[model samples]
Target chain A: MTIRIAAVGDIHLSEHARGTYRAHLDGIDERADVLLVAGDLTRHGTVEEGQVVVDEFRDLGIPVVFVLGNHDYHSDAEQEIAAMLRTAGMYALDDSAEVLLDGRLGVAGGKGFGGGFAGKCASEFGEPETKAFVRHTREIADRWRIALKGLDTDHRIVLSHYSPVKETLAGEPPEIYPFLGSYLLAEAADAAGADLIVHGHAHAGTEKGVTPGGIRVRNVALPVLGRAYAIYCLGGEEL
Target chain B: MDIWDPPHYVAARVQRAIAEDERTNELGIRVDIRGDHLFLQGQVCEEDQRERVAQVAAEAAPGMVVHNEVICVAVGEPGEQEVL
Candidate 1:
């Protein structure tokens, strides 16, 4: 059976965004089997902002899974944000995997960091600060790989907040590539043989791309999609 | 006569301009200088805000070319409404 996934990211929900999404997201459960929020669920990582996002999805009646974004860490309340979402019946994953649809689909998620792409990326061989910066991404990428490896479902979906490949980040400025995402996340997903990869964080990026292993990568940032959400039917059509 | 580094001077001027502007201050715009070029990067809520930010940067750095990399997001109106 094909699993319909409705995904979007970078909602950046704030206090003012309390009721903005419900109207746009109405009937999502009837449209898709599951909802995947790629990240940036809050504007500044406040519990109140997180509450706004949770309120929108509280009665969506579908399994909602999400990862945290860089913006969600702005106020250092990421833990509270995740807790708020979880309390509202959403699965907030960070370097973890969850099986859904009665073991039909497995989602591996991580708030992937940025360190540029291959051939022009940063390395851990530089100064202490540079090493730490690159190392953080490396750790998250490694966790992502491990999480995907642990999934035992029929379809594997890798979800993240940062773009895994440069293909989806096309419209974003090339100078900010290092800060937009890292290629390591792509390598991990490709090696793990994912059916689909969903991410956000690149607002100016394109919507679609492919991994080296031919897995489909999508940037579902709200601005890029030009809609409240997008539905992608995985395992039904060959990409 | 006071000597000024073109890029640094432009960066400082643009920073002050953005900070002093009510409409752009909360946008968190970042200014970078490369030689005589000034790069503005950030997200603004509206199209006019993007233009305003670029215009402010250009005016702050008169002789430098401004590269406006600011992205404008069309966020819908925010208010309380009945949940469906």
Candidate 2:
């Protein structure tokens, strides 16, 4: 059975965006079985913007899963936005796991964080502030590792707002790579295992990449894809 | 135009304002200053947002000529399906 997974991120919707973005999703049900919104559903991360997200994403007639991006946390309303989306019958993942397609597919994810990649990444050895920054990514990675391990579904995908590997962030300036994503995320998924890792937050990044462990990673940020969404088919006789 | 703030600093300030200003909280826009001209490049979801970014950049650096090169992101249809 092939699971058609439609994904996009960095929608950046707001009150001004009402009735503008949803038109792209017309008849999405026919194209894919599920839609996974990687993150950045709002512009300023305001509660009002959260309502816009709910209105646009709700009643899509398919399982729509979401994770918050940094832009969605700008106003410190990430929890409220997630809660509101949940109340609207959407699945919101925060360093957690959700099984869809009747336990056939499991997605584990959160916003993810940035600390750099591999040897170029940050470390815990430093001042309290520096340590905290790197530690934040480490802790999120730990939770994801645990989440991926607990998922018993046939297919597991990790959704995040930050890039897990440098390959997907090719267009972004090399200087800002640390702020874009960290290798720790890829390490976690590699340790626990997953079919794919989907992320955003890299507006200029490319659409496809693979982790050092050979797991596929794709950046579905709207600007990167230049499309409303990208569909990836998993677990079929073709495979 | 202050002697203490160089063109680089002006670019940085405009970039920061574009990201931090409530009127235009766009993170992906890049600001560059060449001579007396300030160039703004990147993509926004809407045309109005692009104008607002230029407005914010102009306000940040009063004397420079603001060139808004940012384009509206055209989100087309879901193209093809990639089988994994």
Best by DockQ: 2
Q: Taking the true A–B contacts (Cα pairs closer than 8 Å), what share appears in each candidate? A: 0.04, 0.87
DockQ values of all predictions = 0.12, 0.80
Per-residue lDDT of candidate 1, residues A1-239 (tens digit): 77888888987776766786688777777777899999888766777888888888887888999899987887788988888888887899989999999999999977999999999999999699999999999998889889999999989999999989999999887988999899899999988778889999988789889888898898988888777687887666522
In terms of lDDT, the poorest run of 10 residues in model 2 chain A is: A230-239
lDDT of 2 by residue, A1-239 (tens): 89999999999997999877789999999999899999999999999999999998889999999999998999999999999999999999999999999999999999999999988988999799999999999999999999999999989999999999999999998889999999999999999999999999999999999999999999999999999999999998433
- Every candidate's lDDT: 0.82, 0.94
Where in model 1 is the C-alpha error above 4 Å? A237-239, B1-84
The share of true interface contacts that also appear in candidate 1 amounts to: 0.04
Give candidate 1's root-mean-square deviation (CA, Å): 6.1
Candidate 1 lDDT for residue A229: 80
Instruction: Report clashes for each candidate as comma-separated counts.
Output: 1, 0
Which pairs of residues clash in candidate 1, taking residues 3 or more apart in a chain or in different chains? A116-A178
Q: Write the per-residue lDDT of candidate 2 for residues B1-84, one digit (tens) a residue.
A: 645778888999999999999998998788888899999999998889999999999999998999999999999989889999
